[model samples]
Target: MLPTNSCSSPTMSSPELKKVTVSLPKRLDRSSERWHHYLTIDLIWYVLGYTLFHPWTSWILVLCLRAQYTKYHAPEMKIAMAWAMLMSAIGIFHIFSERLAFGSPREVDLSDEVIVITGGVDGLGGLLAETYGMRNANVAVLDTKRVDDEEAEEKGVLYYQCDVSDAKQVEAVAAEIVEDLGPPTILINNAGIAHTKSILDTTAEEVEQTFRTNTLSHFTTLRIFLPYMLREGRGTIVTVSSVLGHLGAANLSAYSASKAALLALHHSLRAELAQNPAAQEIKTILVTPGQMSTKMFVGVTTPSNFLAPVISPAEIAKSLIRMIEKGDSGELAVPLYAQYIQILGALPVGMQAIIRRWSGVDTAIAKAGLVKKDTSEKQ
Candidate 1:
């Protein structure tokens, strides 16, 4: 509504600007901060991790008690020591698990890698492309949304106008990217479109388009650009999926079904890369983010804001960049809840139904009046 309903001329004329729209609440100034604004499960968990769960911080509690000359057998001293030991054990186990699973981090020099990001003109993809551009990395963006030369130059990212769902267009753009930016070593398959309509009411064309863009596009980009990555000997592929992929919702049948395919694709892609000896240094990252505060889900609203807060595109972009640059393979689930959504499937059928209702996972679209008779793609 910020762009569509705004009376200001600047907001009305530039529709592309709508892609940057965020959730209602933003980072509030201290003077404007209210108690409710500071309260969220994420915030509480973050504070607890640093102060209570942190190994180093928990040890400080033991040190303070000892400095007071309290006996080791004292209840306070014993409690502190036990807590610190538990935290340390968990930390060591986490490190060991990561090493056992991913082996070692691959070296990455941004200047040497040619990066290609699909749907890089807007949302999380756009932020990542711009960040790499500023770092002087060779970056190429393929998107249906066209960016003029002036704007592209200003942002320092090469813009190629192409619909990623079409394999031919992607192949053509892949050739240009190789010529212009060298062999693409980093491919971010992020192009996606959502069609929110009931399964019964949705048409064949709409379903096919959604799958082509959201699911098959990953296959298209990987097939076209992955060879260069294999030849380069070192590369990173980031697949951006959705949390809804694990838990489908009403009126989002096509969108959820398409995203679900990405989960399978990411796993299959990782497995193939792992088996290839040449892909030892190649890394794959899967990002499954919860509801984002972006224009792509303009009308949608989460039923519980505290439990499932709307993560900003910038936050997810930062995590993606950190993993890609570090040259590590892993799965990223934003806003905490995304990481646990799979647990729902393991629960009893009645329990799963109850939890889904409580979480408002299925009814969010209909409640928000987001379902439409005419389906249109929104990126």
Candidate 2:
């Protein structure tokens, strides 16, 4: 671990310094890329949001009509004015609804907060940890993966080698974190593992491992670390789930079930926190992202690039950081589809099945031949 006093040490170079020296990975080749890659529903929606849906943009349209000497009673002018008012009303209502649901956001000072991230050695967790470290936040990472002392020091993060799935290990690590950094006020539970196997094909051991890592780890961390937040009377707990959790796939039975459990857990955490008077300042953020370009889903392909474009870890991280800093409890669902997935469950059973089949939700893994085989097959 780097010395606690290393933050002020001039000898310790910033992690960004390594970025200058290290060669970055090459961008994906254009020849192999498809036209669909450049065009997605998300891109179109984003453009529409800024141009068509934006209140200011709507007003601009009205202004254009007026500039053209259109009378207020003219059909085009009336439509434009009505549209602008509707957009403005929607924007105002959205802000008011958010405030009503989450209450006021608490002030977040990065310097005063100690951030703890599980699975911080790699992927989204690593990205968040490094970002905070660069900002000189007291950052601690608990993961089974170990980072070398020099690299950890250079990154300005304390790496704790702990298997977060194990309650004992998490408890021990929590103690160390409390001692190293002050009691962690920001808890990011992003550690998860997946076994691409059918229910029958998945062994009990593998299923147990998946649950331990994905679901139980949240309980372990919360049980151990939540009291610290309670004592401090303020904290932000981030739960990273998956869109597949709501729409279970054929070959991802164990993985999906575990993530599904997290959805319930997140809501339970929020409800319980609401009951506690002292927990009013404790914010809970739930992140349900669609297929991300992380190593966990490296070979996995989305069924529809237009509908469910693969999200970047960086995008999710940015949203999480923003929510955490704003100290607001909210759900961060990416790829538009993820946000509205619950609507699928509300549809007719026959329609739901048809939609699922059309979306190729159950067949993606099997078609890709990425299904995990029995241990006997490997042997």
Tens digits of per-residue lDDT for model 2, 212-295: 999999999999889999999999999999998999989899899999999999999988998899998999999999989888
Instruction: Count clashing residue pairs per candidate.
Output: 0, 0
Between which residue pairs do clashes occur in model 1? none
Worst 10 residues of 1 by lDDT: 24-33
Q: Write the per-residue lDDT of candidate 1 for residues 57-113, one digit (tens) a residue.
A: 999999999999999999989999999999999999998998787779899999899
Model 2: clashing residue pairs?
Answer: none
* Stretches of model 2 off by over 4 angstroms after superposition: 1-25, 28-36, 375-379
